[model samples]
Every structure is written in C-alpha cells, then in structure tokens.
Target chain A: MWVIKRSGEREEYDENKVKQALLRSGASEAEADEILEKLRGRVYNGITTHEIYQHVRRMLDRKRKIRYSLKDAIFSLGPEGHFFESLVARLFQETGYAVRVRECIRGRCIPHEIDILAERGSERYLVECKFHNSAGTRCGIQTALYTYARFLDISEVMPFASPWLVTNTKFSGDVITYARCIGMRLLGWRFPEDGGLESLLESHKLYPITILAIKKDVRNSLLTNGIITIKEIFTKKDRIYDILPELKANEVLYAARAVAECL
Target chain B: MWVIKRSGEREEYDENKVKQALLRSGASEAEADEILEKLRGRVYNGITTHEIYQHVRRMLDRKRKIRYSLKDAIFSLGPEGHFFESLVARLFQETGYAVRVRECIRGRCIPHEIDILAERGSERYLVECKFHNSAGTRCGIQTALYTYARFLDISEVMPFASPWLVTNTKFSGDVITYARCIGMRLLGWRFPEDGGLESLLESHKLYPITILAIKKDVRNSLLTNGIITIKEIFTKKDRIYDILPELKANEVLYAARAVAECL
Candidate 1:
C-alpha cells in the first residue's frame, strides 16, 4: 500500500519499517509482526501517514505499548536546567559512567558550576546541558563557542576532563561545523546521526518519566523529588498519593502505565 | 538635604550632580541650576529618590527640558536587533566614522550578516550589536566568544577591520574578563566606567526616538520607517500622519516635541 506523508509526498508503505518502530517502543518481535498483520487490510492506497500512525498507535496503546513523543517529553523537563541535567546524568550513568549533577568546581580563574561530571573508563567528562523552553529554538554558534571557552577555562586546572555540549533540540549549521573543528563532543537531538540523543535514548532505554503525557507543573513536582522514570510510577502505583494528591496521582499512575515501556 | 535611595541608603543630595545629568540631557547650565533652585525646600531630608525623580521629571516635562530614561529608551527599540543596529551605526557615524548597516560580508569559512561595518581614519571595524527586549537580559561569555570567533573568521579576509561587541544591556562578568584578555572592545550599559555606552550616548547626543513615551507597536512602526532621531519627529510634525495614523502620529509628535533636546 502507498501512504501520503505529512509533507504530502507519497511512498510505498513498508511493513518492516513499521515493525522496527514498534520494537523500539518495547514490543516483542512476535507482537510487532502481529500488529503489522492487523494493519495489512486497514491501510489503503493514498492513506495518510498520520492515519497509519494513529491506527498502529491505538493498537499498541491497547496492548500497553509505549507511544513516543520523545521531543516534547524532553521539553517538559525545562525552562530550568536542573531536571534536564538529572536526565543527562542518568543517561551517562546508564551507559556505565559514574555521574554527578550540579557540582561547583574551581576553574583556573574562577569557580564554575559544572552541570554533569561523568566518568567512565579512563575519561572524565564535563557535560553542559543547554535547555530551552520552546521548540524551534536551535542552539547556535554562541552556545558551542561558550562551551568551548568554558572547557578552555576549566581544562587548565583539570586537564583530563573532556567537554561535551548537550542540548535537547537541534543546532544551527555553524555549531556543528565549529564543534567538529574543535573536536568537541556534541550530543544534541540528532546532530551526530548514528549517535544522536534519540538513538542513544532508544538503545540505552533511558526514557525519561517526562515522556508520559502530562503538564509542566505536575512534571516539575515529580522531578523535584527525584522521580525520573515511567517504570517508577508503575512501581509506586499503590502509593500514588505519596507523590501528589490521591486523585491526580492515580491519574498520573494510569498515564505512566500507558507509556512505561516506551523507549 | 539628604535623600533615601531606592536601596534604602541615605545620602547627601548634591545639586551639581543633578545639574550635570540635566546638562547631559541637553539642558543649558543655567536651566539646570534653575530647576535645582525650584527643587529646594520641596525636598525633605526623608524624601525618597523616587519622589525627587518624579519632581524633576515633571518639572522637565513642563519646561521642555530633556529627561533621561536612557536605559529604557534603548530597550524600547528591541526584541529585534535591526533598530538597535541602526542606533549603533548612528553612534559610530556621529563619532566621525563612515558606516554601513546590515551588509553581508564573506568570512573565511562562511558568509556572515555583518551588523555594522565602520571605517574611520586609518582603520575599519566589524561592529556587532546585541540587543535584548527586556532589562536584565545580559550578554554572557558565549556572546563574546561567538563574536570573537566571527572576528577570527572575518579578520583573515579583511585584516584592517577590528571587532566590537555593543549591547543595550550589561555584560556578565566572564564576558568582560574574556574580552579584556583578548583586547576586544566592548560597549555595554556601564562597563569601562569612562567610556561605557551610557557615557558615549551622553557625549555624542545619539538619543533614539524610541525614548518617546509610546507603546511598543507605535515605536516599532516609527522605527520600521527609519525615523530614529527625536529631532526627526519635530522635523516631521506637520506630516505626523504620514508616518502613522493621524491620532497616534500626533501624540508621538507631541512626545517628540517634549523631549526633542533630550540627548
């Protein structure tokens, strides 16, 4: 069957592609194949990608399969950097790095509040989390330049540590060009292609609790107490009232269970 | 007499200080003294600086004496950088430099939208204007770093031109430190003490029309049509409706006439 994309382009619908996406969202191979089989007659020629997405999404949702809106999930953690910092620290930790969030370290000239100090193998890393409140706000050359400058300042005192610029959103062209020139490690939404934040999240299964469909203030209250995983909500279902008011907490728990396996 | 500052500190009121400020605002020395004389006895020892400011501002308004709200006047020009760019270009022009605004210049690695290109005796300059919409939005180390990076790129192609960072707001501490270390010239609200943007504006009479007491949309409309100077409003008083609707233009012209000599 052919599908029309959001961009209005038409292409042949690929079942294998859809199955891989479902597997990424925590479906077993058999379940992904079954979902694709169920989708076979439902998809017609010229059906929109949006319709296909909705159709598959509803089926997976009924099976308690995770639905991914990973971009907005990350944004929900900010206007402030603290929760986002914790999320980044968690990513490093899950990948076998010992991570510390928000440590004030003395640079050569002054004291700098390092966002995340991640150590693994022979390398220690200074990670800067550049969080934005809204979409379409790309990290520009200045962000890259200043991160480099901070690295220059701190490396004088701690020569072993490497600098990494991490952002939840995209980056402008110059940022990537400049970072490559300086050999700086960058982990933005999809800058490095194979090793971007999205792929990293999928592979490491470091899905943030912010991924659950929820509001900012509620997300803040949960993050304030160090709750950062959807599975944590499912684990604490009985004590829903402990996190928030009983009714709201129960609703959050229900929401969490819906997307708990979403990677 | 003594006056209470906004900070709750008490200080002796000096007439010459206010007079100097008034003169900076285009008041004649005699006019400043007369205003000060009128201010006597109305000022109680416990009178707050805010009250004294209101008194002087009201008196100046009545006499058509220039009143300075220099900081806010600059802010009224932006969330966008173009008007602020024009103002900066005007400053350099008034200081005897030949100026061009918003030209695309080729850097070593890429094309750059150069905000202002200024040339005077024996040298040229690449001037970057960093304008913010609101007060307390400061230029951080990243701005300075990215600006320096741009300079490094452009200076290779045009070695005679120096780089300058100008802003309507203040600079963070690291920005100043980094700029000083690199010998980059900075023009901000109050940095160099003798030669900050405020003192420069005072000396050069580069008062912006945005200083007029009007709404942002009205200010934007005027700025959009390249009407930047306060005197320009007085010049176009008869044709006020030409720039905007009759009523708003009339009000604007009235505001302009009140502060026309305000430097």
Candidate 2:
C-alpha cells in the first residue's frame, strides 16, 4: 500500500513499519491495514519517507486512543513552536469550534500571514501565535492590528467576534487596556512553580484564543475541498475580496483554503 | 518648601507654581491650602519643582475620580518606563500581591545591580529591567540567575520553581524550551503590539540561595550603620558576612547599629 504526505510526497508502506507505528500510536495492526487500504490510491511517486510515516500518523490520528496520545506527546515537548499551535487547535476542537491551523490569507496581489483561524456558528476569531520568552503588551497590539486587518479582509461571513492576542507570557497593563479599547481580547499565560511542560499542558485556557464556530458556508467549503496541500489553498495576498460588503480580498482566500483543508 | 525629585535632587518650591499645579491636578483652592499647610514641615531646603508636584500627585492618588484620570492621563504617559512599572505594580496588587518597585538586592562581596524585588505572600519574585530594541535569550538567563542568587541571600527562602526570563521580544524555540526545562520561566512582553515597556521591567523567578540574601543583609547593615558609605557598599572585601546561620556574628552588629541609629 501507499499514501500521500503533507509535503506532497508519496511513499511505499511496509506492513511491519505500519504495524509498529500504529502500535506506538496505540492502534491495532488490523486497524492500520484498514487505514492503509483506504489511502492506497492517494499514494503517488517520489514520496519522501517522512511523508509515508506522516500518512500513517494522520490516518491513525482519527482513532481516539491514537489521537489523544499523539497530541499528548506532541504538546508535551513544546516542539518547533508547534506545541502551542497544536494546543490551540485541540482547544478549538474541544470547544466545539471548527479551527484551522496556519490558514493563509491572500489576495490577487499579495500574501498575508495568520496562524490559527477559528469559527463557530456566526462567530469567527482570527488568532496569531506569539511563542516568546514572555509576551509583552506589544504582542497584543500586533495581534490586534493583524486580526483587524483579517476582519477587514473577510466579510460579515467571518464568524469571530473580535481579534485576539494570545501569548505564552502575560500582557502588560497598558497593552491589555489598549487591546480592550480597540476591542481585542488579549490572553496571557501565567507561569507555574515547576516551570515544566507538564505545568503548561495542564492549563487549557493558556492556549490564547478560543472562538465558538466558523461560518457554515466556509465550513462546508473546507469539507468539500479536501485540501491537504498548502499551495492549492491559502494564498498570500491582501486585495479586497468584496465591494458591497467591503471585505479584504485576502480573507476570502483564507476562508476558501480553510474550508478546503479541514472538515 | 523643598522636595526631592525623581532625579534625586532637591529644589525650592514656588508658591505661585504650586497653586498653578494644584489647578492642573484639579484640586480645589481649599484642598490646595490644606495640602500646602500639611507639606510645610515635610518640605526642606533645595526641593525641586517636580518633587513638589509628585508629592501632591501621591496625595491625590488616594481620591477616586482624580485618581483614575491621573492614572489614565498623567502617570500613564509620564517617563514611559515609570508608567509601565506602575502598571506592573498595579497588576500584582490586583492579584492580591504586594509589589515593590526598584528595590535593590546584593550580597556582601558582590556589586549591586539588581532591581525590583516583588514579594507576594511567602514567594519573592526578582525582576530586572532592560529597555532596548533588540535583546537576546542570554540577557533573560543572566537576570534569572542573579534573581536566584539574590533570593538566597536575603530571606533564606529557597524556591523550587524555575526562574523566569521576561523580555520584550520572542526567543529561539530551542532556547525557550531549554530554559523552561532547566527550571526557568521565559517570559517576554509581546512587544510593539503591547508596548515597549517589558524590556524596561525585568520579570523572572529563581531558586533561593539564603547565603546570598544574608550576605546582602550584613552589607546593608554595615552601610546603614555609617560604618560604610554607599560607594563602599560595592567596594568591600570578598567572603564577608557571617554565613553560618546557627552562629550569626554579623547580625549582632546589625542589631547594635539599629539601637545606635535609634539613639
């Protein structure tokens, strides 16, 4: 069997390798085979080895035991700045809000950067990651502007209520007050005594922004597109997308990309 | 009348200037009369005009309407750095923690460069300020170590928590995770977006080394006794101060000086 990976690569799968990975992820051998079979046609030539591994991992990620452990371990090490990103995603998921990590906002003319965009029902939130030694008030302002820009790019179809600035460290009083004045939510993480990853994992509210849900239209688009590639979706542009509604063009692209990728 | 300014200088006060300032701060003439009279004895030679104003501001800080407006308008923009410090103090105060700004800590044989030791309940937090555009992770680490040393010297309280590294900029992921693993809380003010004041406020946590705190106590005792001047405080010999907790010889001298100063 074979499968495609996130890097647009394909790889041949060894049954033993698949079984071992599944076991590590707490998945049964039979279950692994079932996943491999389902993903067979999706595999293609010139797939990197890591892609093959990722394919199995993504497949097993659907299993409750696999998903929980995989996330638990991933969030524990605080790896590649992905630790907080994953935490944010899981938090959005747990809150019953549809969340997309690394949703690119773009327009016909330009590209923009935004980390996690979430939506629930009519409420939408634009979130940016600030993984620093400490997140000062300055971070809040940057996030506020970024979110506001994102809001401008998207129409009322954008589901979040306000822009959010979430950081690993606490925000200064002035920054918090400024954000409040500008209608942005500034969230900070308080330190624990141990200063270990365990302490961080124990706190979910520290993940920064948590929205209620995404727009039904956006959500449907993502589910239907089955977006797995980064380039096919998420453009990097800031052109206005709407005239009557006066939306930034980049936001529409992000909405499209997010809908295409995660159902 | 005379008062000390933030510059550590004293200057004479002008009555007309005082009257004009009181109006700016929104004090009624009757209240201003009472303040001028109350400040009579406390005023001395060579008081600065700014000091007189600060004194009045401190007094008015007790009032409600005036206090809020003062915080929003005057203090918030004054000296920018002081504003942030005051903000930090207020945040801690709201959290039921008593915060001390610009308190120095040093061991007997060491130089005194530490600043802002905040005590909340049984825990002591050491904060060092850095106001700059670019700062590295090492700066954060150095502050945390010094804070740890200061804690051990002063209160004999040993903290199990990792020291904190608070800054205004983000750090490399490896550095942050490594610092966290070794028991350091890397905190950075999310800068520009928040405000650039985090670099002005050093915030971190560290283990307490009682020996270091005691060393500082003895040095302070000597300096307070007139046996040594402020300049001599940093120039003293190495290995000074009685480190033997059970046999505190320097403490006897400290107590003796206390009595003499009282006399």
Candidate 3:
C-alpha cells in the first residue's frame, strides 16, 4: 500500500519505519508489533503518514505509553515564542543552571532581548528560541548565522560559554553542518543524531504543562502563572483549579502524573 | 469621510495624500486634481485605500498617465526570485555597474551566494536582493542584521564599498535605523526618503518587460531571451517579434514606449 507524506509525496508503506518510530517513542517490541498488526488491518490504498502516526500515537496513548507530544505540546505553547522562552528557561533551570527568560542585555553593537540566559557555575550560555506554530518548518542556516553574530556582539561585552540555538522544529542540513563547523551549540527536534530536544526532555523528565489536556485559556494562565513543567502542575495543585475552575485538582494532577511516568 | 487604511485602520480621508502620491508618480498638479475629482464620485464608506489606489490607477491607465504598476510588475516576475534577480541585475547593469547575478563567493567563515555582485571603477558592491512575492510584508530587523553579518564575513575575503541591500518591499523601522547607523546602502520600495528602487528604475529609464501586456509564458520566454527591459524591446526590436511572435511587434513597442515615457 502507498503512504502519503506530510509534503504530500507518496511512497510505498514501510512497516519497519512505523515500528522504528514506535520504538523511538518508547514503545516495546511487542507493543510495536501489536500496533503495526492493527495498522496493517486498517490502512487504505493511499493513507497519509500523518494518519498512520496519529493511529500509532493513539494506540500508544491508550496503552499509557506517551508519544511525548513533545513537539505538539511546545507548539501548543505558541503562536508566539514567549511561552517557549519560559519553557527553555525552565529546562535550563532544571538542568542545574540559573536562568533568565527574555532579558535585554547590552551587546557590543546593540541591545538584544535574549530568549534564555543560562549559567551553570562559570559557564554562561546565550540561547535563542525559534518557535514555529506549524510543523515541517526547519530553522535555516541564516538563523544559526545570525544567532552566532548576535553571540559575537554580546560576547564582546560579556563572554559566553557558547551560543545555544534552541527550537521546536528541526534545523536544516546546513544549520547542522555549519553549527558543528563553528562551535555554536544547537538543540532542536531529532537533531545532532545523539542528543536533541526530544532526548533533553525525556532524559530530564521536563515535560511542558501544555502536554496535559489543558484548554487554551487555562494553558495561557498556567504559563502566565509560571507553572511551566509537569512538576509545577503537581506542585501548584492548590492554584491550578483556581485558574482553571473547570478542572478538578485531582484530575489534572493525575493526568500530569500519567505524562511524567510515560516511560 | 473615514477611509480604511492598508492596515485596516479607519481614518479620515486626506485628499492631499492621494494628490501627493499621484504627483510623485509623475502626474502633473492638474492631472492629480482631475484624478481626485473622478475618485470623489466613486468612493464609499469603508472603501479600502487599496480600492482608492486601484481606481486612481485605472483612471491613470485609461489616460495613458501610467502608474508604473512598479510593485505589481515586480511581483508578477516571481513566485521564485529567479526573474526578480534578473531584473535586479539588469537595473544594476543599466546604471553602469558590471554585475554578476547569483555568484558564489568565498566569505570569511563560509561560502556566500552574492545575489548581484556589481563592479564599477574601484568600487565593488555585494548586493543582496530580498524579494517578497506578496505585498504588506516588510523585510525585518533580523534580515538586516543577518545580511550585515554575511557582508562582514564576505568583506574579510574581499573588500567592497559597502553591502547593498535591495528589496521590493519596505524595511522595518529597526532595520532602517540600524542600516543607516551602519552605513549599509538600502534600496527598496519608498525607503531612504530620497532614492529608492522606484526612483532608481525611473532615473535609469529601466523597465522590466513584465510591466507591458505580455502573457505569462511569453514574458518567461522574453526574460529567458534576455529581453528584460522595455528599452531592450526597442533596441532588440527584431528579436522581440521572434521571442513573442504571438504579440504584434508594433503593439508591444507601443506599450513599451508608453511605459517608458510614463513620467
């Protein structure tokens, strides 16, 4: 059977590809096989890969195996980069760094409102968060280049450990190649081959609050109130119902707990 | 009466603004007055400034008092920047600069695709063309910043007079301020309050053949055949028929001559 890709290109469906993805998202061999068997029985002649992905995610989610919704949850935080910046700040903070989000600093040439300013002991990091509302947009070489340039300007005034570029989307091939050649640190979706934002979130258990089934207004209020992570959801059990009012405190906590223990 | 601005803001209609724009587009004072008189009969409450602009353009086009369709013509040349790049190269060449369009050059850090590299006497210019397919999108500060950064990289390999940025749209306020501060030359629609792309084209009598009544395929073939400018149509009068045998040579020439003598 043929499968349509996100770009609307069609190719023959590959069961191995589906299994690999399921395994990557923390599913077991038995679970992957079971999901694929179910999928084989359901897929049509020209089913979209997105539909296949959603099917697997739903199956996994039903089995209490989280798909992370890592990319989607981050996207939910934005049509703007504001919440993503806060999330980035939290990630840095949780990783044992003192962090600041959206702080304007004097560079050698001009002032820059840095997305995340992170420091662990003697190592200071300058991070720029590039958030996209939709999927399939990659952070290009130009963004990486400008981030490096901005780092240069700021470094002249005050040195940094390295310039860190973070994003919700993937980075282009040139971005990956160029950043490696120059010493710019990059963190984004499934990049660097070994350690990307997915690994970062999974390794640290730093799931965003938006990963839970929070409504739009409630999510905004949560971000505004600085309940950025799942840990914060459990921590702020008293205040969440006050902001949401619609959600019972236990249901939200239970959901947050379920997401945290996805692995 | 209140008029709707491009940003959808309603403000009292100022006839002087329209008159001044008409005058700037080479309409005589009497002609501007005549156009305004005609506009008064048709405008409705909640009518967009775009509609007003279009109505005036129609009247001017009817009188053979050409509005240049300068922005629209440039937009027609693209869904890609290829034709726009060619147009830019021609503009530079017409102004006595020996230009190379889309050439790769060695920069300080990496390779750069210098869009229009122009050399005149001892002065060399690295021109970057930022072409937007649609209206109402301005080249932002980040673009300006990155362009400057790229220039700095290229300048380390070979010195140019300055990095020249050309666009078919306006620059954001910070871009304008920053570029002016850094002495980077900017040419785009209605910028610098003096000479812009509109002025450059007018001063040089250089008009892209897309401005004339050439159909899509014919225009593409014309561009491919190096019949970019209207003056080229006149000069290469023989070849114009060969490239577009569908169009009568005399009619095309007549239209070319009309657009050329718009001022």
Candidate with maximal lDDT: 3
Descending-lDDT candidate ranking? 3, 1, 2
Q: Is candidate 1 or candidate 2 better by DockQ?
A: 1
What ranges in model 3 sit over 4 Å off? A61-64, A246-250, A261-263, B5-12, B61-64, B224-226, B246-250, B261-263
Q: Compare the candidates by DockQ and give the number of the best one.
A: 3
B260: Cα error in model 3, Å: 3.3
lDDT of 2 by residue, A1-263 (tens): 45454334455655565566566455676776787787566555655555555566566543333332333233222324544664555555656788888766652212335577778988888776665532122343334433444444342444457766665555555455545554766554432234322233333322111111234354234323332122223431221222112242345455444433332
- Model 1 chain B is weakest, by summed lDDT over 10 consecutive residues, at B61-70
Residue B223 lDDT, candidate 3, scale 0-100: 82
DockQ of each: 0.24, 0.01, 0.47
lDDT of 2 by residue, B14-65 (tens): 6666665565455788877877787675667876645555566666533322
Strongest candidate by TM-score: 3
True contacts recovered per prediction:
0.27, 0.00, 0.27
Q: What is the lDDT of candidate 3?
A: 0.80
lDDT of each: 0.76, 0.44, 0.80
The CAPRI classification for model 1 reads as: acceptable
Model 1, position A112, has a per-residue lDDT of 72
TM-scores of chain A across candidates: 0.71, 0.40, 0.89
Task: Give residue B141's lDDT in candidate 2 (0 to 100).
Answer: 29
The interface RMSD value for candidate 1 stands at: 2.6
